[model samples]
Target: MKDQAKLASDPADWSIVETVDAVCAGHASALEVTQAVLDRIARRQPVLNCFIRIDGDRALETASGLDAARSAGRTQGPLHGAVLAHKDMYYRAGLVSTCGSEIRRDFVAQTTATVLDKLDNAGAVDVGTLNMSEFASGPTGHNLHHGNCHNPWNPDHITGGSSTGSGSAVGGRLVAGSLGSDTGGSVRLPAGICGAYGIKPTQGRVSRHGVMGLSFSLDNVGPIARTARDCARMLSVIAGPDPMDTTALPVPVDDYEADLDAGVTGLRIAVPKTYYFDDISPEISKLLDSALAVFTSLGAKIVHVDLPHHDIIGALGNAVGSSEQCTLHDFWHQTCPEKYAPLIRARMQAGFGVTAVEYLKALHLRSSIARAVSDAAFGDADVMFLPVLRFPVPTLSETDVGDGAGLHEILGSINHCTRPINYLGFPALTVPCGFSASGLPVAFQLAGPAFSERRLFRFAGAFEAANGLSDCVPDLP
Candidate 1:
């Protein structure tokens, strides 16, 4: 193996795939690629605190075995030498899987999550576990159990979570890619704030088995990467049916990497003049307007649509999510209440107050709203464009006080434009559009009908290509 000490001294030399591919093609082993990522993590972890755990020794062993097998003319998978990270909520067998809470700090599953197994089978090296919001609940990336993960773009600002570390680590270039869960825009919010690409795949499109549940109805496992193309590539591997998750749809996986350069000509796109554009900073509004202009310039027909009852969807989404989350953690709450974060505990407690009749009514309301949204916005359009979050990341102090009323107000504001689609179970992509005046990243989302990730990705990939925003990386201190 190449000298680990030398690789540890230089991380940028092995940060992107283009660099690793060139090195690997010239006989650099998978072990070398894995070591390079470990080396980078060593350099980055202290500053970013993006990872909860680092298993470099074990990763090196796996990489070396794969390299040895390949040396004997054995075939490996598509992501043969790629190194990736997963959110701490994902269960990797024998690894301590802390779902960013004291409740499950010592929990280790006997079996790995199907998504992790799929990535491993595809020959991707698991470099480490990224940080996340406790119980995958909050919008701001504050973790009372682990320290708050700072945004790479601006360490003083939030990273947007429950997928906090996934966004930060990838944006900070600590890892090439990472997996994140989205319930109420967890993945996309972080993607927007941290200047990364995030995909919240359609619910049940990817298996939720082996993941710590936040909201059974709304939780989605997806990818966060530096570019839309990278997100697509990772999705191709991690997405598919899993017998362990009966909710997983039996759909065929496509070659997401192919035809990525395809433009969005002739596609109908809509901009909803509703909750999406309300109350956001004027700079964010202007940035989104500029992004929409790019779509118009690329031959996409821009249409104006309205969803008058959009506000109800956000209310109903929170009710359903909170109720479901409470149900998932009833035992923990009853058995060890003190272990739970006060913020999460309060929200979970609110769930008990939500009656079954109300939960069922919320579901019915969700369906009605989804149908109305589809007919009004997506009836003639391939994708809908909107702001990912109404605002950019706030400071850590603002979010960490466990002030339930203030946190709810802020989270509700951030999820105002995002939770509606989660209620409807649609796929959404958040790509960086511009930066706020304070140098915080801002992003706009592309939402598509159920199982229309390909279409959404095509549109986002084109927008990314034209905008060339992926090249903007955070200059970490």
Candidate 2:
């Protein structure tokens, strides 16, 4: 096992640029890069517990085959030989597809997820499965089923979830990129806390065919990567209609990497002045101010907007999510309640109490809230900018661990800026903005209306290029 501290300090050793350059120049084989990732997993897994399972032998075999084919002048896909991992919630045939809960710990999928198949076809090798929040239920990243995933930046701090391990793995540089499911900021919140880039695509933009569903209506799968270009590359492979999922839109895939260098000139960016900024830490607020300044310098018009129904959006999102989750696990809870974590069982039980009328009312409120937010905040802008999480990452020791009032407050605060977008089914991207005073990372979020992913990427990429923040990497243990 390699020393993680040594690997963490050596930025040049971990840069994706060097890995790709080596492969292209024939100085290193993709098999070798894959092997290195596997080796790092072995070295770091004990301390990080980032992976649920490591298919090192299969990964090496596939990488070697790809290298041999490429050497023989055979063409490969865009992501040829890139080492990748995904949250364990993604169903890969014959692999255990646990949603980080005891009930489904041994559940195996007969078929692979659409996103998994797409990535494999693109020539990305799956090295392992990353950890995640149980059933994608909580936001603080504490999982009673598989232990909490610690932040790579500061091990004492929490890695925001339910995409806990996906964020930690990418932040820890254990793999090139990973996929995480975001229902209500599962992807972006962790990415923000861990200093990575994450995208929560529009609902129905990507197929949810084989993913473990928490909320069928709000669930979205997206990439978490070290850089914006890498995320775009992965999205290119995974973004398309799937015959298995009728709800998936047949939207055309655009090249997210093409206009990355193009500045955000003549772009209208909205900065909401109400709920989004309220109760945020002063340091985080300052970092957002600095980010807005960078956009202003890049010739983007920044306008202040308002969202009055933000509180309603949050409440409605919880109602919808809890109801959907209850429906998914009703049989399991009824038959084998002991298998579920206590907190999850309680949450699932709460759904049973929601009346049909209440559910309908919540749905109606969701629609109205979405319309109000769109009209007030997004009417004049290409996208709206906000924080991914309300504050810096919390220490693992400090967050609530049980289903109590403190736990609710912790979870709600973590999802404060994110739940509304999920309820509205909008697309969002989170990119690192600056570091907190304690040296933890803080992120700024950008969101737009449905199917506005390309524009979101364009604006985010432009902001990334101008700020040059992605170059900052954390020192791992």
Candidate 3:
């Protein structure tokens, strides 16, 4: 096989973009890529437990069809012949979609997700489903039903959750890219821990029609991949107005990869002064400084910005998320609460007393708060940068908050930089910067104004080129 290097589950193995080009140009066969991915999954899944299901036979069959189409001189779409998997939350018609809960263990979706449909039309192969937090509730990647997804960089470290499998699979190179939902940092945290790139686009930027709802207002559908270029390719195909989702923004989707090579020549970047760096460890702080120096070397100017209402913004997000989750699972909570995990059950219960007036008031403040964050960030900068996680990625044993000792404090700290941006309805991209002393990766998030993904990718691409960070795969020989 031409892509024999793909068998290692190493990040430097293959490219989603180039794979599509080669297959469509008759230079490579889709079946080969699928076989390589299946082989990697076999080797890596046992160690990381990243997948809930592996549809190897069906995936190989699909690849064979794509190969025939290419031989017939036909091209599918921009993503033609690329292989992928997604968080089990995304629906696929006629397939069992376990949303990481015992309550939905046998639930099968009747309609497919719009994002999945877009991907299929683009010629991307759906290999299987990845693991996630039980009901997408926790922050430290724990799932009582499905097994926890371990970090690929260090198997003992937690893979930041709800989108746990998405991060581990991409970082492990079992597939080129995967769709992950981000409601309060699910996508960002795993990216940081697993040493990969993840983007949570603006609220309503991607359709959530057939996606299981964790929070109708705060949920975002985005991509996790080895590089920003791969993410840009997937995001371009999945984003835009969708009739199935009324909340999808009507904004015109730009060619995300169009300006990725433009560089950050005159771009303004921000390093926050508060909340993000609060209580951060010395190692992470030093790493952030070094990451900024790389951007400075790329000709971007750094400005310091702060959000005094950041904590409030994050609290509001949590309040809304919990209340919405409780509202959706009311029947289950009332009758089958035992089916849920103890930690998430307690969190869901926290929203029971949220008065309608309180929830409404919180919703009303979102627009103003978004404007406040935007004003502070864009006043002197185009993008705001901060560490995705301030503390080191703890062992799975260190984060079992279900036992209730400091439960709130422990879970709250993991989503520090992530939840605030979701509440603001902005875009944030986490790119691996370096590894921590414990061997897990450290990352910095680049957040931009609403729907500015192109600008974010441009800056990220430039910094990635300067640092050569994503290409540093784990030595999985």
Candidate 4:
């Protein structure tokens, strides 16, 4: 093997695929890689505040075991030797899953998340848990409990919620990849703002067993990684039917990485004529236009689609999600209201006011709305392209709108670009298209019909390969 110190330094810059290849080839041992990752995390965590917990000892132990197995002539899985972390919400039996809140600050899980089990089987090393929004509420990464998760690009900028640390850690190169949950825009928002690739798979594509619930109807589990292929590798391993999570669809999981190399030859990408871009800033618009140009250059056709029901989608989605969240936190909200952050409490209270009629109506209309929107969007296209953020990345101070004053407006506007897709239960992938003038990242999300993750991966991979932006990392020290 190469010098241990040199190997460690280089693997911090390696993609998940590269890390796996090197470890499997015996070019580097898993122990060395885990140590390198821990060292990087130690240096970066204080500045970024991305991790809620760092299980260094556990990670090294896991890595050493993998190395021993490999030395014994045993084969490893796809993610063998790939060091990863996750949102603090995903449970591991007997481990404390804070869910980024003081409410469950010391709460120990009785069972492990299905996704974590699958990752272990795939040979991924878990270093620790990342920070996130309390109870996965809010879109601005304002965690009054665990401290806000800052953007790696600039510590002052917000790192989109509630999968804040997943995005920050992955983009900061502290880990190879991370698993994050998205109720509305949690996964895509963070990944986009941090200049990484994240995919919110179809509602039931990945099992949610042992994961904290925000809005069961809308919550999705996905991965954020440096490249589309890395995201694909994680998704392929974590996605599939789980007997533990009845909500997981029985449909067969597609080979998400299989068609990644296949360019978007004649694929049609739909651009909505209204709603999505209604309030976008000129700077963001230009970047998206350039991204479209890149897609066009790669042989994909861009079509203007008159998407249906854009006006009511966000409101309806919020109603369903809020009601569900309130239902889950009703007891604690009623008794221990003081434990929650003001903004999170206020956000949850909106759910209580949503009557059963409104809640049922929202749930009842989901199927019809999804069908109409999907038909309109996909009638002549393979996937619909939309902005992840309508404006440039905002500073933490600007978006730290506390509980009572201006919370709804700020949170609503921040999540405007991603909520609609969650409402429709479609899959969307966040691809970093370019950087903003302020040096923050801007991204576009490509959304496709339910269970179309493979198609989204292919398109995103092609764009990433062409633009070569996925290789860009934040200049954090």
TM-score of each model, paired residue for residue:
0.94, 0.94, 0.97, 0.98
Q: Model 1, range 180-252, lDDT digits (tens) per residue?
A: 9999889998888898889999888999989888888999999998877778878988898998999999988
Q: For model 1, what is the C-alpha lDDT against the true structure?
A: 0.82
Give the top-scoring candidate (TM-score). Answer: 4
Pairs clashing within candidate 4: none
Cα lDDT, all candidates: 0.82, 0.82, 0.87, 0.92
lDDT of 3 at 3: 55
Candidate 2 lDDT over residue span 116-161, tens digit each: 9998887788888888888887777788888888888888888898
Off by over 4 Å in 4: 1-9
Question: What are the per-residue Cα lDDT tens digits for candidate 3 across 282-386?
Answer: 999999899999888888999998775876887787778878988999999899889998988887787778877878888999999899879998888999998
Name the lDDT value of residue 455 in candidate 1: 82
Report model 3's TM-score to 2 decimal places: 0.97
TM-score of candidate 4 relative to the true fold: 0.98
Model 1 spans > 4 angstroms off: 1-24
Shift of residue 121 alpha carbon in model 3, Å: 0.5
